[model samples]
Target chain A: MTVPAEAARRRIVDLFLSSEERLLQRWTQLSGASPGELRDLYQALRTALSSEDGDFADVRGLLAELSRARVRQGHTPSDTARLVFSLKEALYEVAEADGGPEALRGFVWFSRLVDDLGLYTFESYTAAREKIIIDQTEQLLELSTPVVKLWEGIVAVPLVGTLDSARTQVVMEKLLQTLVDTGSEHAVIDITGVPAVDTQVAQHLLKTVVAARLMGAECVISGIRPQIAHTIVTLGIEFGDIVTKASLADALSYALSRSGVEITGAARTRVAVRAERA
Target chain B: MERVPILKLGDILIVSIQIDLDDQSVLALQEDLADMVVSSGARGVIIDITAVEIVDSFIGRMFSTIAAMTRMLDAETVVVGMRPAVAITLVELGLSLGGVRTALNLEKGVAMLEHVRGAAG
Candidate 1:
């Protein structure tokens, strides 16, 4: 270490260790660390400063731990960075009191070191937050793609939101698995929950239908509102031989009819109407 | 040599494949099924594969071939009770068993075959 840096480091540590109450007060005012945590943080900071060139593994390791800790504690980037910058205030007080010609250069080097540490903490905080967001998105995709058994020979998947490739894969897998497990020949893909049907969404639906056919199951796509039907026609997207319905009820009825199961409810209604006429 | 049994139920030919069908067995079953359809004058063919866990490209092709041959002989083929994993694997393998009808279970498969026969007559 340089002569001035070593001297400045020792003086900074003394100021930090001697006036522990004042440092703790400043830390508490800036963030949410308890007295016990402030003690460990200050102790680690002291050890980090004594290390050569501030590029030591100990310093890097401590900054990473602190960054993650700050994120978990719901601390903002500025709040976490402020934790490191606060130490500089303490160092500056001691540096000014020293009143030596080299004190200025030493304080400047110390300030630069603190700035680097503060930025590192901020970087780690953002990275942790991004990972959290990605995990939540995966969970949401799983929740949205649900396979439901509609009848003895029919199962249905009601898809909602955007149908990205990853979500489509999940939907296809779940739908196909239910088809096999239930031994259902017909699968109704109810896209009523789906807000819009773009070309890409149509393509995903087509791929899923083809995959179901490969499993020896017939796929019926349902929930085509007027707008979606128009969009599909305007885009000139052909669903080929796949059966599509305007509603889940229509698809279910089609599936039931294909399976040759008669809905007695309709027959009863007709019989009741005939009885009333008689 | 392993063999998958082909049983006759009324005018319907029921082939319940309880074992994992190898290439030889699959071929034998196909030949036996085609012969049975012609000799018995069956109206419908139901191949129940409820125990089947895998359907590779070869088995997939065999299914389509059987359906086509039976249809040629004036009999409808319905494959039933395919497990989800097998379906997924078949789909991923890019095998869409066209011209082959499927039902969820033995009862449904039989019902589907009978329905087609009923519709035709």
Candidate 2:
């Protein structure tokens, strides 16, 4: 609320009122923003400078919206900030043209206000960018862990990428929920897409299996690559009695057999006769 | 202290815990379940905890103790209808409820007991 001397305020307001159009035009050209966007900011800045308390709330609000829009448009933070700083240059030209020590002094106070506003715009831009990144990360977490129903009374979680505690928690919750929803007695955790299997990852897997067992569902871990098997043996990580298979296909057949599903091959000659008739 | 009721369905003894399990009720229920299993000669015991929202380490241990006790009495114990949150909490607490069978619901629990008894017979 530092009302830079009454005389300086009056001088700036008078200059703004007399040449508002010219100042806005110059600001648009320098900032490379549309005239429509510059017009709202110009009016708010003029009102703020002329007000008794010298409040810049309206100006800051406009800048925040501008920065958020610029962030969505993929503009850099500095680029959004430069739009506000360029106004100082536009106003300086008008103040210098008016001529006199008073106008020059008033320009200094105006430049300080614009500096604060420019920094405010930079902060807003970064805040908006951070919000976008957080939303995307949440979406990726949900996208990565999907509980798919492989067959009647059978569910599978195809885990991909590195297994972290947070991702494992999501997978565990989703798998358990699906088990209850479908009333499936068996779940197969397919880790074919998982890159590595460290002790921590093994611990998470064991915890998940234990949790599912507590809920009365059997879990079969599949897709153990040769190198992962060696690492697991070297690490002395015991999967205990929990069944594991080398591939997803092996796991599926195992689950089917355990569920009492007899998968007999269809007659090939009957299929060929049907195809020939078609 | 509220005593947990045990309903006998043929050879299987069903105990559905619908209230918050304090220490006193848990101990009383364990004693009662043991006595019922002996007197009734139930072949299977199913403890349904679908309504239980919270469980401490003590309550978690009760499950293991009950399973062991029932087994000693010539009965198989199946903890059924355990809420997902309770299951996760028990796992986090490192109480795997080992040696105790579990099923998704009451119908499944009965089916599992039948399957076990049939296999054993």
Candidate 3:
């Protein structure tokens, strides 16, 4: 620890104590941190400066914790970083008290330390936010690929969003496991919620369908909108004898028939009544 | 010699693989299955693999080979009750086991062979 002169230490401490209220108010306004939080953070910083270690570990640790809390509280990275840098304002007034070359060198040293701390807080804030984003993405992937039993011998997987390889693997495993558990013979994959279907998405669908076939359950892919149909044709992608339908209802009926359940009476009467009306 | 038993259930030949197949056992089974199909005059073959766990490319290829050979002997082949993990490994290993019919269980497999025979006749 490079001991600053006793006069300089007393001057810095006195300046920090006098401007404590203003510093706290500034940090709270900038980071949306409560006044109580600012007081605890300032208290830690004061102890770090006065302690024999002189490493500022306590102050850095407090700033890291504050950075994570501010990130979770929806504060922007720049705002969170400002909370650390704002403390330098009170320290700068103390640095300005000495006009000699030695005092100027000491101020520069302290400024560099504070700058590094501010940069550390910014990095921690971004890292914390990135972790939150990745966690939510994984959760959304799981939530989007749900396997539902539509009938006694049929299961349906309704997929939304872009079909990436990771998502397709999850979809395949979940659908295949459900098929085994329920002993269902047919699986209908409805992509009605998918925003757009490209060649990669088509390949993912094919891989999933082929995997399901290997597990002994036939797959029916439904929900081909007009634009997707146009894209499929334009890309010259071959689905190769796989049954496809424009809607989930058509796929359900096809699956029902494949399972030997004839949808006979009500549908037939409706058709007959429509013909009679015509 | 560890021989995988091939049981005769009426007109259908049931080959339930209860052990992990080595190269020699697999070959012997293939030769035996072909001979049995010819001697018993079975119309269908159901190879149940529910008890077996690991299926490398060799096993996967053997399945394809058996299915093809059975077809030549005027018999349909249905591989039944494949575990989910085995299926995944097979697919990841790029073995589709194409031209082989699969069923969820032995009962469905037999029923499928019957349905195929009935449709053919």
CAPRI-style quality class for the chain A–B interface of candidate 1: acceptable
Worst lDDT 10-window in candidate 2 chain A: A269-278
For each candidate, the alpha-carbon lDDT, in order, equals 0.77, 0.87, 0.81
lDDT of 2 by residue, A1-278 (tens): 34556577578668877898889989999989999989999889878877888898998899999999999999999889999999889888999899867778888877887898999999999999999999998898889888999988899999988887778878888899888888998999999998787887787788778888989989999998888888898999887988998889889888888877766656554322111111
Q: Write the candidate numbers in order of decreasing TM-score.
A: 2, 3, 1
Residue A166 C-alpha lDDT in model 1: 76
- Model 3 chain A TM-score equals 0.78
Candidate 1 TM-score restricted to chain A? 0.81
lDDT of 2 by residue, B64-91 (tens): 9999999999899998888777888888
User: Against the true two-chain complex, what DockQ does each candidate achieve?
Assistant: 0.37, 0.71, 0.55
Off by over 4 Å in 3: A1-35, A43-61, A98-103, A159-169, A192-195, A266-278, B1-56, B69-76, B83-93, B114-121
Q: Candidate order by lDDT, highest to lowest?
A: 2, 3, 1
Best candidate (score: DockQ): 2
lDDT by residue (tens digit), candidate 1, A157-236: 88887677778777877887777676777999998877777787777678778767755678898987788888888999
lDDT tens digits, residues B17-37, model 1?
888778988899889999889
| TM-score on alpha carbons, each prediction | 0.68, 0.85, 0.75
Model 2 CA lDDT for position A58: 92
